[model samples]
Target chain A: MVESLVKEYTGKLPVKLLGELKDKLTAQKINKTRAKKIFETTLQEYLDAQVAPGEAVGIIAAESIGEPGTQMTLNTFHFAGVSEMNVTTGLPRIIEVFDGRKNIATPMMDVYLKAPYNKGKDIRKLALLIKQSTLQDIIKEVNTDLMNGKIEVEILSAKLDDHGLAQAQLKKILEKGLKGVNVKIDGSLITLAPSSKESNLNDLYKLKEKLKKIHMSGLKGVTHVLPVKRDEEFVIMTAGSKLKEVLELEFVDETRTVSNDIYEIAENLGIEAARTAVMNEVFKVINAQGLTIDERHIVLVADMMCVTGGIKGITRYGIVSEKASVLARASFETPIKHLISAALTGEEDYLNSVVENVMINQPIPTGTGMPKLSTK
Target chain B: MPKVDPTKHILVPKHSKLSEAEQKKLFDKHNINFNDLPIILASDPAITHLKLVKGDVVKIDRDSPTAGKSEYFRGVQ
Candidate 1:
């Protein structure tokens, strides 16, 4: 009877909500008459709770987000000692998301890996594999004596095994990578004393710089990596994001690996994913700040920014610039520039938006003022 | 190795182009114009397989966190 009865309100209310109502009704001793009354009242209340026609929801959403935003701290909060990645958090993160800035302050990625790797197996090696490693990263100290025409590099051999590196392999790499200097490996120490050419201080300094710049391992754009165990799985959280490159890795779970960069997401995954990222990122910051804004507000903002299939920021050069009303665009930023351009184009402001109407001292076509009455 | 598919990504929702009848019904229900709906690029990787042209309406079945499951629509551009 409950299943049959609930079917009546199918399109009127959400399926899940109706199912819950049906479950509640079935538990109690209720007749068909009482059940119908309950269903009818539920629908009535749902309708009553809906936003009234012509309500200015955009303004409300802005105020709701902005009010709590003022209290947020600017500093990036640190996770326990394991992960020292300085991810942009708080108010700055919110601004960055809304602005859709290409060069974000701290672009990071949550790179999920496949199988045993995700379960913290050979984690340090995996981290090293992902991290952009240079000769400088492994060097503990470097001593250069211009008098002896030699530069000795002391390696941190303690964690070399963790990075899946052996002394011989390192020696070979150093030998192949450097041309001017004769590379000599003595256990954990590497001595580069030029044999063919007598090198000066300047030549030695340039060689030192070149040695530091040698690309040893890892993908491009992923500079720092830390294997972090979250819940039951370990995720390789990286300081820099190279979504395309990371996704291409055999061990990486391409389906789940994600970058916080909105532009990167848009370029690779299209605008819908970019929109979702915007919403999720904003939600994460707001949630972390102990603020409770309705998720609808965030959703609306994301939809507005991504509605045109290209992600646009809320800034003057973005969403604001594309407005049909000249007054609206002028109001956002650079008043004279927009006004003059509108004049040149012979643009007519239809006064469709609230700002245009307010400029002309007309009743805004929103809530209460929306309906017009005619008389003969 | 297989190339990554944008449509199969976790963040992307299920997308399908609606029939003309379905589009008409949706517009009638919402009292909406084609321009009023959100716009999706014809070249969007998620919908490229559909071979949709500009002006076609797309339906997205999104499992939204706040509003539960909702069906959203966009006009191809």
Candidate 2:
């Protein structure tokens, strides 16, 4: 039966696809006749779902996502019980995802933990470990002595203990991060004196201000971390996103952990992961608004973004400007700029794309326009 | 060339480049030109493992919600 099925699909489909179908049917434990019926139905469904030649898929995708975007709210919402984390959702998020904004309004991460760590582990401790606690977080007071040109920072003993930071580590951090200053650690009180010849009273005040933002502990760029229970598993919801650094943690489930920032994901996990992130992020925002857009549309959009080996937003400056045809780019936005640039570069307008064809009032090379009659 | 780990993601469609004869047959059967088909870049990670040259036709086996599985073709650019 398998041999016969192979013979039937020999030239019709790829070998790997046929093998996969056979495996699927065999796994389902279907009888030979039943398998044949299933295979036929599957093939029919596949053919039916396929876009006909010249279908304006880009337009369809745009409309599919755009129409539902109208129903989306403009307001940002708190991520469930995670009060500290406000996720940018609705129409704004859709725009952000499509635009492929690098620095998102509220970059967050849903960090899943591995094994025992994901269970009823010390979630509070984990949250604290991920939250980026600066010197200001642990400092009781910061003062500058104008006369002596020295800055004094009194560390809160309790805050230091709470963050699990030793005085020695804090001193090291200060010494390494600070420049043109001498760090003098006297118990919980640290003093910064300018070692540079040009330093004065004004520099001391500036140093005091800069000292407050010095990295003390936890992952940098991660502002806050809130551990929430979802489906009986504890997951960390972070305010700021640092996917690469966070994934390096031993307890983190790298496969499942994801960030809202597409570029960061692309940079860390590769373009394929970024593509998935784009789709997931788009779905999340759209789904939150109680609107159902087809996943295929989002998939197409994500594919377009990552197809160039990097994420490029749907904005005019991004994917639009990169369009092959001069007229297509001109039609998008700032037509004169694109036209002039193309002219200067001696770029040829193929007029192959839908927009370029439409611009010149020619029949689009899609659907019936896709085929050209050739007589031999 | 290092093989692309297909098992790394279930969402990404499987990509394979067709031979010259297979590509010609597909274009003829579909009554379409290379430019008429949707495009996937030669740099696409999914097909990068294949080390496909420019103008090669890539066959993608995507798992569809409506259809159990479907085959789509893109001309590599």
| DockQ per model, Cα | 0.65, 0.14
Misplaced by over 4 Å in model 2 are A1-42, A79-85, A142-152, A180-182, A191-204, B1-77
lDDT of each: 0.87, 0.79
RMSD of each: 3.4, 5.5
- Candidate 2 CAPRI grade: incorrect
Error of 2 at B69 (Å): 5.8
Off by over 4 Å in 1: A82-85, A139-201, A372-376
Clashing pairs in 1: none
Span of 10 residues, lowest total lDDT, candidate 2 chain A: A9-18
Cand 1, B chain, TM:
0.91
Candidate 1's TM-score: 0.87
Give a tens-digit lDDT track for model 2, residues A1-376.
7658767866665455677787877667767898778667767876786788678888899898888877788999787776767778888888998899988999988998889989958677777778998888888888878878888888888878777788888788898889878999998888889898778777777787888888877888888788888998999989889876777777777667878898886665556567767888888887778899888888888878866667889989788867888888888789999888888999997777788888779998887898888999
TM-score per candidate: 0.87, 0.77
The iRMS of the candidates, in order, is 1.5, 7.3
Residue B37, candidate 1: Cα error in Å is 2.2
Q: Summarize candidate 1's per-residue lDDT along B32-65 as a digit string, tens digits.
A: 8899998999988788888999889999988877
